[model samples]
Target: MGVIIVLIGMLLSVNLSIALDELPCHFLDSINITDGNRLANDDSIEFNGLVYSRKQYAEINYVLLRDGTDQITVDPYIRGCICNIKPCVRLCCPLGTLNTDDTDITVCQDHDKGNKFEAEVIHKNNETKVIPLERFFAYIEGIPCNFVYFDDDYQITHKGEISRGNLSTKLTHQNSCLHAGLNAETNEVDLRLLTCIELEGDDYDLNQYHVIRHQIINFCMLISVVFIVATLLAYIFIPKLRNLQTNCLICYLICLAISYSLVIFVTSFGYPSFACIPFGYFLAFSFFSAFFWLNVFNFDFWVDFQSKHRFKQMSERKKFYLYLVYGFGGPCLLILFIYILDNTVQLPPNMRPGIRDGACFISNILWYFYTPIGITLTINYVFFLLITLKIRKIQQDIAAERSQEDGSLMQKALNEKKETCILYLRLILVMGLIWIMEIVSYLMDNFSPLFLITDILNSLSGLFIFILFIVNRRVLRLIKERWQNLRGKATTNDNDTSNLISRSAAFMQMNPILTIK
Candidate 1:
């Protein structure tokens, strides 16, 4: 693993608008002073007791210089903060205490009476030790480091994080990382992190960061569910908006809501009971249906624009009914097929949903869930490309037709419908991008809040849909008209009752002598 020295806050400002070829930041590997390959921007590194990737340090100044002294490089696929300095890492850990309550640092010295800092060490033989930092590095100088710290350190009680620069680190100030190649056996990157050894720290304290991350995610999920429900209610109450275009959206949102609600349930309460099995399958079915329905929406758009089609003979209502069968039914069929394979065949642990093994969330989410969604997304991408190219031809044809009739009423209506289709297309694109982030993060092994923004976006997708579909001028105007009509009906009923009472009284007066019980 190559270690790049990080300079915290010393960078000169340079215009970022320069051509990619001309821009000379630690971008050129040929000019890199470091004698080995550099770490990718996605690799995690720790500094000042906090763990994060170079990509996450957006505030840190990292002006790359032309000289070959900098170890950091701007990867074509990912970028990192660069510094022009010799690559070195501060090697230190919390000093040992007499006991859990001891307030004084119990200095453990070496042969020459030089100070020795306690560093956790785990060897290939599964033995763990709490020895001096210098000795520990000597032990791991030629091996892959994967130390899982336990509280059983014979002579050390790990307390605080590997921070406190004011504390003594003079012994490790000159320590530099050894260069190494990637280890393919364990699918592990040769990442030489300057972070502290993985120690048994306070679980709550260590977990608070992740807890807040999940809270943000849940908050957005609930917000989306609320808006999705609200959008459905609007359509349910206003019959005018329940046509083919909106129905497609409704089916997609319903599936999404089901999937989101199920996920929230699993995350919040967890599945410790027998109900887990059913919940897991239902969750998969709902999620797959959502993607299927989304694809159906995209397909409908593409098919409608096409001139020669079997569905062209049928009404919009008929086409939508057929779509419903495929959207919801197709996922149902997939779930059944999976259930059969799971029971009959001896599938690998990763291939089978862990629901059969009593796990709450579907175990091995990628193979079972993402594979199908990936296929759906691929199809959507192809359809989207075709749809975009097809729309231009549609606009031109419409323009010619309008000119022939000087913008007839039918042409005007077609234009308005075309505008709505464009809006829905934008909605599809937004959903696609947000979902793509989830897939990317999974592949990248998201361990930190570096990709928290993507989760936030995904969770709040319902709000985005609500804003796009329900909170628009067209839907709002329909709601206003519906309210006004209801009010007018009430007023008219009251007036009719009053007229009836007046007419009855006049009839009685005009025929007072002739009146009888």
Candidate 2:
């Protein structure tokens, strides 16, 4: 017994000896910085350059609780360090005085554990209802529990969705199941299995540790949007660029611009919570519209390769209008599908659009957004294959039999198609690689250090479009011609005005008496 006492004393001395700075800082899970939220540890937020490990935060928070420090001052200094139980959870932390579980967060598991519960809850602007949920806690310590997820929209949410388990549940119902490690003056770190849930509790405002990172991302996206708008203007103002092909390019750029701009707006925190769904819907439409137009561009090229429609550009106005329907209208249908799902009661909680599930915007990215994008990309690939086959057949036919005029016409059309194909290829390569990086980053939870690569590529997409379409030799040549025409017309108009003035002066001088009358 004396030896045991000596060992315990040594352990106490060791714990006391370690300075606050020596505690191990929890590593970031993703550079995208999910709901983990620049956490200094499981309990404390890294605030005003202050940091604390899980053990350190709990101990300090407990000390403050004993000293009667109000939550008003404590909230900014700590997150997930709860004295009250209503909003905090203990299941993830541990129950009982000596429970040594190291789980730092009250995160929902990917798979539900044990039996599920049908939680009776208030539906906002609607009647009360019972939601069948699998996971346990509605709150992770002091903060409302958030889902663990990887998605494409890091900017709009700048965080993950708050856990749905707690979303609709009433405070009383939520309080019952909620548990968190508390520093309430106890023999050791205290845990209350029950009776700790408060009627009301302090709200923790999660401090954003690196605000500059998000600002830089938004600025880059805004810059890309400006370039996209510029490309649209270049195409629209030039009459020579109003051909069906350029019109298609214009449509794509317009959608691209709208999407990028919306990204800036939503992420900038310029809108209210009520506007999240609509913002998400429009953003989805713009992105899908851009993708659909790219599909139309590919399809138009494939048809041009067919000898029968060698001059498809001549009567392409009608077809271009139809292509607009497919481009714009298709995304409408997709958005409609999402809305239907969002409103549907039969769908599981996780499968839903999740715009409000946690982070806002279309949170179920795989189902609502990327899936449609993948399908469209696959169709574009098919068109690419067909174009390759058609080109081979045309070359064979031209070699086998052709009159001088027919061969020349065919050869000219062939060169145009080849040039257009190269342009399409470049566009596809850029967008495709970006999308691939995005998916990889979304799925790669372990590679926090590498999120920068994918994010930079994403922010540079509009800039990529500017380079691919606007900076090309053909567009530049047309811009040059348009500039010279404007200059020539300006010069001619000036000369004509001078000549008229001179004639008027001569006439007035010759007939001064008549002019005075």
Candidate 3:
């Protein structure tokens, strides 16, 4: 096992580096510098957080140097800005002053941050000294640098030229990505700044990036598969584990495993090549996993508050049916509703903006952003709040019962129940917090680096449930006791063998006469 793990790591490092080298350098190098250019032609410069249009730039001098340096390559001199300029047409006013024709101009500014604060470009066989916002039209037409920022750290100082039409933007900053957005109708280029930092000596290769992404995806898929296989075996072979499968944890595990299988199938086996099916499977199953885990959490309230009155005497089959109706069935209904919405409104699995790993993934759609996530979060939050209250009540009940009882086993049991309630409350509260953080992080932005944080929270959430449900002391003790009982029964049977032999001998002695005859 140790040797296998080491070999896998080695393979990943070597292959990943090789694959990264295969991806296009230009694609990876396109990081968005935030507010890269701010036009400030007027006397006073106003610093707004974003780029302003030509109309707004007329009155205000805006200083917009791009932020998000960690994600972008910075060249101090080359920057783009929006400014207002006067056209060729000029009007003679009544006061004998010529009013120049004002027009919107996108000015490409080049600055020397070094000792030479002034620079010039030879245009039309004339050397023109660079001035702030002067000859805006000519500068826009002539100057070279389209994107610019300062490099604080000397990682990649390779100076590159930008062709007039060559422009791109990073759609997302999740990983160091460079995506281009262009307006074909107007022939305008809009560069999108991203927040992903390219690693030093990072050679971008399309095939390599795809392979790395596939491997990481495969690794995560493998985790899901292992959990699924283990869960299946535990349920099928382990009698005790099988009997203990009444919680939401198992339901979540089952759903997650199924979801992963679906993803793996679509991505690898290509069973459902239809766009809608993969997205539906991804959303439905992922949400189901979350929903069921929350449903498990809802037990805090149900078991404590409504357990006695609602389903206390209900048959096991009825309970199973009820869960299936609400728990499993609800997600299915939701998927159906979403599908209907998609079909009617011309929306389904949203195709990602850029080419993905040869598979169409659900893009960040409006529905995913607001509707499903909002609904799931609300459900989980309400469930957690209600469960927390019930847990407190359970603890109180245990305490009250213990106080009334004398020094009997009943009192001890009540005390134990109190402790158990406390533990359950802590567990549920922690679980709720984890989900809250995940939902919050996800909703905030696509470029959030906190995805790793959310992933960690998810992993911990699973680990907590695993420990609580399967590895808890009480559960272990139950298994141990069952094993001991089995051994005891076997030992008794073994001892009875001696008695059986003696009884046989006695029977043989008594029947000796009869036997001889």
Candidate 4:
């Protein structure tokens, strides 16, 4: 009976020891610093990091440990020890206080001396060795962490992540026009010997001088929204404006409006994961739709100039249907293809979406967004150039015909042709300029004055469209006529009301018994 009881006691002791040993250590990489900053005083956690710095003072000892994600200062105290001893003995430390530190370290904590903690240190062969407290925490080998790179302007340009043994990753700084080859190992990055390559063009500081630029862009977008709304209303209410050409313009305006609205929303509230999908989708779709409509416009303009008689013969409904397919349908297909690629393919760390410079934007701009836009813009620009040359030739022919003709009516017709040609030329020039600036800005990674110009022009695209198509002399005349008709109806109704009152008074006067009141 005694032997059985002793065996049972031994098994229970072994089980309890296993349970204590199995307790999980809290990893620094897993804990978000933003949330960890809010931890309660009584809560205990373990984290592992590389000891990057150490300071010894009469009062206390300070050690800075860097986990790939962040850094924290730890105060290692040896209880009941005086500074008189040349060799320090090891002791266990507890209840150390951590505060915030700001330096090259992404995030760091400063340890206060007021917190009482014990640490163990040993002296051997005239050298002092201390057991690493980090060993108590789990050691992370390779994991991704966000890195922010600031340019000369102090403006954030590149944001990405680096993991252990990632030596070939390239980081760019637009202001200096240089690229940094990262060497990462064992939860630390050494930027001491960076390789740089110079690029063309003088760089300017957007961070220092962006206030005025932002003001200009904001004003342009505000006016653009107003004009876009007005133009949309006119297209809906006016029957004469609902032709094939105007239909394409309406689609373009709708896409621009959606894009601009989303930009405002993201800049104001931010792009959290909860809102990222829908916001990213609509933003991309609108950009695609805008370019696709521009392509449709280029094609239509070419057809109109090349074969005016054939264009006139073609049914408006058929043209509208064709434009819809190319403008809306093409973008839809492209977006879907991108969506599939994003889901199936494994993306690099820098290409994945998350917080960048404290702002959330669609990641992988080169592959997912800019490539399609560049292709579309190239095709449209080619078409537009060809159309411009053709129209100029037509205008010259009309002028020559007018020179030979004797009638004033013929001269008037030639003048009208000249005006139409000039208008088309101006339209193409403005659109081309905006897109060219956009491409350049992206290529240069939005360096300086070029980026400023691109932002302003892009924001005011709606305003340009409204002025070119909606606020014309003919549209103004139509609006005036409509207003006059509405006023006439209103006045007529008021006069009819007065007459009915007069007739009622006459009837009451005629019938005295009926006028009892």
Prediction RMSDs, each to the true structure: 22.0, 18.9, 21.0, 20.0
lDDT (0 to 1) per candidate: 0.57, 0.55, 0.41, 0.50
Q: Ranking by lDDT, best first?
A: 1, 2, 4, 3
lDDT string for model 1 (1-517, tens) is 1222222222211333221223233232112222223346655544323234433323222334322234354532222222212222232222221111111111212222223334444455645565554442321121112221112112211221222234433212122222212233453222222322332466445456567888788888999999999999899888767767678888888988988887777778765454666787898898899889888988887776665568856898899889989998999998887777665677876677555544544676787777788889888888888877776654555556565543454344445546767787888789888778888887886654546878899889999999988887767877776677777842223243234435544433442221111
**123, model 2: CA deviation in Å?**
30
Candidate 4 lDDT over residue span 413-469, tens digit each: 434544554564576678767877777787886655787778888888778877887
- Model 4 per-residue lDDT at 165: 29
> Which whole-number lDDT from 0 to 100 does residue 505 have in model 4?
42
Choose the strongest candidate by TM-score: 2
Which model scores highest in lDDT? 1
> Could you give candidate 3's per-residue lDDT for residues 407-493 as a string of tens digits?
244334334444554555565567666666666676785335564466455543444555555576655554555466767842223
Error of 3 at 368 (Å): 2.8
TM-score of each: 0.54, 0.56, 0.46, 0.54
Kindly provide the TM-score of model 2 when superposed on the true structure, using C-alpha atoms. 0.56
lDDT of 2 by residue, 345-410 (tens): 558868997664435578778777777887888888788787777667656665654654555545
lDDT of 1 at 306: 60
Give me the runs in candidate 4 sitting further than 4 Å from their true place: 1-135, 138-216, 308-313, 347-361, 395-421, 445-447, 489-517
